[model samples]
Target chain A: MRVFITDTTLRKGMQSASLELTYEKRKELFFLLSSTGIHELEVGVPAHSEEERDYIKYLARSQHGDKVIVWNRANIRDVEASLECSVKKLEIAIPVSDFMIKEKLNKDRDYIVRLLKEIIPYVKSKKLYLSVGFEDVSRADREFVIKLLECIREEGADRVRLSDTVGVLNPLQTNELVKTASSFLDVEVHFHNDFGMATANSITAFLSGAKYINASLLGLGERCGITPLEEVVFYLQLIQGVHTGINVKRLYEIVNYFIDMTNIHLAPNKPLIGKNAFTNKSSIHIDGLTKSKRTYLPFDPEVVGSKAALAFGLYSEKANKLCKK
Target chain B: MRVFITDTTLRKGMQSASLELTYEKRKELFFLLSSTGIHELEVGVPAHSEEERDYIKYLARSQHGDKVIVWNRANIRDVEASLECSVKKLEIAIPVSDFMIKEKLNKDRDYIVRLLKEIIPYVKSKKLYLSVGFEDVSRADREFVIKLLECIREEGADRVRLSDTVGVLNPLQTNELVKTASSFLDVEVHFHNDFGMATANSITAFLSGAKYINASLLGLGERCGITPLEEVVFYLQLIQGVHTGINVKRLYEIVNYFIDMTNIHLAPNKPLIGKNAFTNKSSIHIDGLTKSKRTYLPFDPEVVGSKAALAFGLYSEKANKLCKK
Candidate 1:
């Protein structure tokens, strides 16, 4: 029930093409995220700019309760910058697969591991809560993944995060990877929603034994975005009976603030925070729901600061009549 | 890899409040559905009105190549009307849960089973492909569900549809129940997206062994709508390696037609059909994707008649620069 939300909006969400939160806006957003019970923030890459580095440093020092985590590559300079910024948590992201390391980073598997071993101790020397991220872990070989985790654990890294960098995993695969990895070390899941499986994958990871999940508000990240915080919070609390320490009612408010600030339209069908998540439009459903809300609802909408609306359309006269009455 | 699409927009989607497709519009819609490669069309309830019954008959006769199924309650009158309309497939809907049977239908479990037994033969006598619908099947007791399936199977029902009437199922439960039920009968899944689990649950059911799925175009139905046809089709074909009989390239045309005919706006983030489903917004993703679309895409969007867009706002310049270079 001790759920940790690692907000990747500054890093991953910035990848959302239309979203442009300035450095100052990013700092302001952290305060808003903190108020929503987010325990950690994956602020941004320190390698981006001196301004970005200074802002990350400012947030690391100035933010009161929230753990300011810096996302960085396997390079020592990025790790050192993150350390210099005094980030409480340093996520050292290393591409694990042949495709990413060879194609993207132009490095071999051994070099990636060697790079992590070299940088992790430097991070540990700074006494930072080190979470080594295996980028594109889903596509990485299982044995290689195990080897990397073992190496990281031996290097005194605090934990390892399984990143579904490409969002290619299904729930079953997610469970297998998380469970297998958890047996070796404390594992966290950082899922991408490229296939719309981010939230589901994250929940499966949690249920399968992963303790920490990486989430961004509204599933906002690069490509399809990361795991949605609202969805993870709702499922963990309602279905799994786990407490996330989230003020459930404040979810809508926080999401709305981000929508307004980012000028991104919240899709009405987006899970949890979307307009249609809690609304009932069918007459048969409304009639049954009117008798007992449980007849049509998994959980009360009010629990998530959502109100049920009567969707008026061709087949919803009963709901319309009930609403009118 | 053979996939089947059952459009339930008329039957289930019409149940939404303020959604009224006139008889003529309904017929036009039926024709439109038939033009698509959709395998089955669940036309409206035959017992709803004289007009509904006549329309069902007309569609059953005219909609060649597409199996016209009629929704009916587990009652003699409804079954007789469905038969009179010559619907080759009959989905006899009955509340399977104690809550629905007792509260909604004011009947006991025994009475419900008896009703099914009595109606099953009447429909089978007409040589109709019968699919018994267990409304609220997710909430029903597992043992009772097994028993109901057994009775339906014994009574010669061709298939059994497990309706997540209240949308109470998570992926695990959906898999377990569908797997168990599929062991007894040809299982079809009908899901409501009340908790954003409809598409996930439908896919889970298919993975668990269910052969048939019910979906509405654009996810148009009651409450949060049914399983999105586009999501199911895309995931099945792209991920599960299943061949849905749909003309993949024509999907966009069909979606556009539905949007125009219904005047329902497709949310920008809707999977497959939505404008943003294939749009790249992140600089990292755009950089990689522009080089090779496969870098971030699970499958080619053009396969489903969708083209990826470069969504630009705050994240535009860097991503655009990377793409242009």
Candidate 2:
């Protein structure tokens, strides 16, 4: 299945405490992401600041191949702000959970539904492709989520996204929610990694038939981040035969650029991209690998643009047992 | 299901390139693991060296609460070395994959099976409990794996472990394998995280009725390492209600001790134990949290011995609208 990726490295990635990407860094990463077969980019909210607004506008006018999608709140003012960027696509986020509606947004669900009814058509009139984002949908009532989607679909929204804002859902629950929501319309999944299952949940969401999954460079974003782009692409490609059109060779380059910007060291054990992911240390494993690398390798590390580093220790030496019986 | 954890911190964890836990460090971590409600400790292989053999013997004789299980190869010599440790239980690991048996052991599967026949009775005569470990079983032919298990089970083996030595299996495949193997016997899962699904695969193994899962103290070990003990226990406890008998309060402390000894920094975004796993941002999440934290959290961080650190950003200030709504 063709899995579309919306890499929000420039948008949400800036929210990470450890990252402060300069405008040049964001532009560099944006083009790097485009080079990695990423078709969509969630350029930051234009309303965040004048500089950000200018960057969004500049990105919209860039002669890049990526589809520049602007993010904004449910309010019409944010939509008005987005128009200034001249982006052809927009994502309007609204808090759908009762607690979030009351406590966070300080607006009832009815207020969001009413606002969407009023603003969606205006967005369509401007000819911007649109998707409505349900913020914190994991904690929202499923009935209410379905109801909201139905209304947004009726208003001619092209797609819907369920944001696991608190990163609470497991794979099973993610599957159920995505399955239910996709029944109403083609759905995207935006996940946070608070519980460390974001990548796993992303896999489950795809298994449940999610069309779009959000990932980021270095998984750089707010608290615990989203699924790492390299991980989802590699797992889906190697294990599931799903393709994200990512150039595996460029993954290390993209991550390196970001880590250079933030100086944040990626975890040594961070799945496909981590330092030790393909390091073989056990003597038996190394011995087996010298004869047939497949004997000790899950996949050729070069598939993800990495080489196997044989570690020095008890298992590093080729022992007598590895010889002919 | 009662999930058994065989913490191989000193055994397999020693194979990690980045770790060199001194004898003092090993002693400190071993006692700490025992305190974490962990019942089984695969201390080390007695065949490694005089120092390692002495350490294994020491751990076997220590007045510790954890059951010290010694590890050895399929050969009787390794088994003989394990007997010197005086451990009541042992794990005899044999390569079942054709490539490993041929390349690593320089022997055919038939020779390995014959060796098991010779060694099983010898191990039994020593009055030691035993579990035959299938090394690199993920890539092994299933029919052969099952056949070997049937033969070993007949020899009075207590259990068997399926090691995803190359870390190739995804969750679905993990479930199928564990399900198939557990139907034959009580199966423990030992996973390496080559593709970053080790934790997810471990979770799936549990869901598929696996009784024992392997973990390490620092998520440290050979190549991508085994599953992070903290991630597995935290996810299971909060999401699955499968308690590991661990004192939730001591998780951070336990991890810190290992990190301190190894001088390894936990990834800021590492799940459950990462710096930001419980960090909250976005004014909306903060607002919802003030009214009821559940609205913005999957589980209380305090449950994992962590507290929420509110991020200072766009939503850090409590706005007027939140109070009225």
Docking class of 2: acceptable
What DockQ was computed for model 1? 0.44
Cα lDDT tens digits for candidate 2, B202-282: 878888889998888657777778788887887787767886877666866888666766677567777776677666665
Note the Cα lDDT for every prediction shown.
0.76, 0.78
Worst 10 contiguous positions by lDDT, candidate 2 chain A: A316-325
TM-score of chain B of 2: 0.93
Q: Compute each candidate's TM-score over C-alphas.
A: 0.93, 0.91
What does DockQ give for each predicted structure? 0.44, 0.48
Superposed model 2: Cα runs more than 4 Å off: A106-122, A303-305, A314-325, B106-118, B290-292, B313-325
Question: Where does model 1 sit among the CAPRI classes?
Answer: acceptable
lDDT of 1 by residue, B1-325 (tens): 4646788988886754325678898788777766667788898887767878888888877836237888887888988887788777889888988988877767788898788888898889888899999999987888899899899999999999899886667777777898899899998999876555677777778878888989887676665667877778777777778877776567668778877777765445555655667777755556667566765666777776667677665534556576567
Q: Tell me the TM-score for chain B of model 1.
A: 0.94
For candidate 1, the TM-score of chain A alone relative to the native chain A? 0.95
